[model samples]
Target: MTEFDILVVGEANPDLLLRGDVRPRFGQEEQLLTAADLVLGGSAAITAVGCATLGLRTALLAAVGDDFFGALVRDQLTTAGVRLMPYAAGGVPTGVTVILSEPDDRAMLTLPGTIAALRPQDVTDALIQSTRHVHVSALYLQPGLAGGLAEVFKRARSLGRTTSLDTNWDPSGAWASLDDILAHTDVFLPNAAELSAVTGAANPDTAAAQLVALGTTVVMKDGARGARAWWPDGEAAAPGRPVDVVDTTGAGDSFNAGFLAGRLGGHDLPESLRWATVAGSLSTRAAGGTAAQATRADLMP
Candidate 1:
């Protein structure tokens, strides 16, 4: 029996969000005109929080610095009801993101700090063997975690656990061994831009198909256009539901969470896309990363 329904392996950081911002011009300093909100965020941490919010038995495997920010990391996870694995590194300062958002949208500048120190060994056999699903984020960013990640995914696949990869936007296309990573990925969730960049394909469909050829299920997200899934049998697309947009920060994370939740509930591909799309859309109605993520009651079969 699986001890945990999901395990999220990745970074955890504190977020300094400044809303109602005046634009910051390059080479010119802009003064803050309003109060900023501080929140907790990190790819893996957000996903784990979303999973827990949706009532999954979730665990987080991450490394946090032994510092003030690390304390905040633990507090946030505790508040969200996520089980924390033993952390790896000590003394390194935890990661932080400075988000400057206008009333319409936001821009984030990140300090990777301790998040960059994550290694694959942080994911132990005890956690991997007991988890039914394992989700990883930003595969291309961290160097130390790459090799361990490779082994972790392979072991999870061998153990009959579903593995999901959220190949979040990689500006430099950092990670070299993407193909090897995808081989162990049962489901891949990437935005349209990421799909195209990762596969070097001309279009989303082509990119998704290319991913499928690499031996994994692909769920491609196209912001307002909605989401699409490509499998061996055929293709499925879900149109985005109309909703009032607020902040897009955590939209993708919520989508992944909802989609995984649906799949774990035995929904088919199309239904899973629909569920995820709705969850993502709802997330944009609020300001912070997790603001609009749905509860189990919010998502009904």
Candidate 2:
């Protein structure tokens, strides 16, 4: 039997979230207000942590530099119950993200570092065969991984493993190199803005249809509206769970974990979507991505 339930491949970094009066003023003045937290970050890392918390045997395969931040990342992943299979980075610097957080929205400044350095060649055959499902995130940042992920997913499918992709946000707005990737991907997870950006559709509904036509299941996170899925066999959606928002960081990644965990546990599309909605909403209860991530009991009880 395959050992791991999910293999999350992509970025690893720490996020420093500063909340309350975080608007930057550039007059050489020091200002601070409410809260600041340095916590585990990166979409793939957060998703892996969420999956592990949701009762999946999860692993993270990504590069983290041999530095203090890298050690921190390792500690965070291990503590979260996700196995860390670190890539040999030749002592590069670990990546970090600084976020100015608000209830409704947030702004992030990231140092790409090892976050953008993960490559497809690093996804070994052993890793693919050992996992029932493979999930990749932050394709926009991992430019090296982006170009070659289709083949990696293709190989996973041949081994009877399912694959999913969440190309966080393309910073340059180019949105290149997805047609082939989606062809090999079983599930394509994107937020409404990401969906529209990736497919150039007038709206997320049209974007989902466009991607579904390409033979991949489309799970589009609709922010406050919740999540919707379109597959070859069916379509389903769930409305957002009501909650007082905290930080939206990593909420989508948490949603990815919930949906994947539900599907791997044999839940139907609608129920899985609902699971994803609840997970995502609950994640916002804390400052960072993985802090308030949901467990099965949290979702059920």
Candidate 3:
């Protein structure tokens, strides 16, 4: 029997969010007019929390330093009911992200600490065999894992496990060397910009089509406008929910959680997209990614 409904393989970090209306200046300047919050972050962690909130038996496999920040990361995941299979990166400190939040969008400054230390070796074969589905997030942030990601997905597929990949923006902008992994992936979740970056297509529809042609389902997340999904059989678009946007920190990850949760529960693509849209839109009601996430009850009629 599968031990976990979803196994999330990626980074584990904390986000220190500073919410305000002012931008940074060149010279020395101090402008603090709003609030500050420390919350659970990292695409994998946030998605795991969102999956747990949706009543999935979610497990997180990631690296963190044996430090206070690591403890905070673990505590938050445990509080959200996600099982942790964390590896401690010796000597390296836990990763942390400084998020400068505006009304519609936010800029993040990340210090990739232990996250860079995560390797494919950290994901054990036993863990892969025991999970029904595997989800990898923030592909570029984890260099150690990125190098062998294709093999990892292939191994999961060989084990009869469903696999998903969410390649969050690559800082280096070299989106090559992903075709092997994309071919093995069952679901490919990318934001509009990431889709364009990965496919080199100016049009979002073309980008999605290109990924679908690779034998992977493409779910393109378009903020405010909504989400679109393309598979072999057909394609569908779900309109985004209108809400007072607070911070769009981990909305995409939240959307992944909802989408994957629905898929694992045997929901069709259209129904899954509806849950994904609502989960992502609701996540923006707070300052951080995991905050304001929808629970199972919230999705009920």
lDDT of each: 0.82, 0.91, 0.90
Q: Write the per-residue lDDT of candidate 1 for residues 1-301, one digit (tens) a residue.
A: 8889999988888888776645777787767556565777887888888889988899988788888888988998998999978875667788888888765556778888877787776776778888899999766556788766768899888878889998686646553547888888899998987887788887877777777888899998888889999987888999877888866777888889889988987889999899888888887887777767888777675
Candidate 3 least-lDDT 10 residues: 21-30
lDDT tens digits by residue: candidate 2, 55-145: 9999999889989999999999999898998578887799999999888888999999888787788998999999999999999998898
Candidate closer to the true structure by TM-score (higher is better), 1 or 2 = 2
Q: What are the models' TM-scores?
A: 0.94, 0.97, 0.97
Candidate 1 versus the native: TM-score? 0.94
Q: Could you tell me the lDDT of residue 90 within candidate 2?
A: 80
lDDT of 3 by residue, 231-262 (tens): 99999999888999888999999999989988
User: Which residue pairs overlap in candidate 3's backbone?
Assistant: none
lDDT of 2 at 113: 88
Sort by lDDT, top down from the best: 2, 3, 1
Top of the candidates by lDDT: 2
